[model samples]
Target: MAVVDGEGEAGLLELEDDEPLEDEPEESFDAEVPLAEEPESFGLASARASFR
Candidate 1:
């Protein structure tokens, strides 16, 4: 005697139900924010004195 099963059918249905119909759009950031601000000098005496 031989037996057959359909276990994969249930798994396929579950996967299809879990899938999103449409992808959400990505959010935008502020354009006014400066991205290239120069780093502060730490080793020079003049750089240290400027903070005072």
Candidate 2:
């Protein structure tokens, strides 16, 4: 069994002032690196293979 607490609510209130404005542009999750410049990382090759 687990105990419930009000501390979670308090922490949320503390962070509410730091939240981003709704109008700000959200970041894109797409590749930050250009296809030609991507480093020869291990899993990157397999991941790119699946995309095509």
Candidate 3:
């Protein structure tokens, strides 16, 4: 019973930690993936052509 109670408390703490991560994925998807990809694609092509 004591071990079960300790595990339950740890699970609740993990849930609290995870709540913020759930919010961050939205910005990560938008800023890291799409936002980064679009500029890199266009800028890299322009840079390559300019270099050659």
Candidate 3's clash total is 0
lDDT of 1: 0.45
Q: lDDT scores for all predictions? A: 0.45, 0.54, 0.79
Top of the candidates by TM-score: 3
What is the Cα-based lDDT of residue 16 in candidate 2? 72
Q: Poorest 10 consecutive residues of model 3 by lDDT?
A: 1-10
Every model's TM-score: 0.24, 0.22, 0.35
Candidate with the larger TM-score of 1 and 3 = 3
Assess the local accuracy of residue 29 in candidate 3 as a C-alpha lDDT between 0 and 100: 81
Which lDDT tens digits does candidate 1 get at residues 1-52?
1223656677666667555522322111223223222232334566778888
Give the alpha carbon lDDT tens digit for every residue of 1-52 in model 3.
Answer: 1245547787677778787889888877877787778898999999999999
In model 2, the runs with Cα more than 4 Å from the true position are 1-40
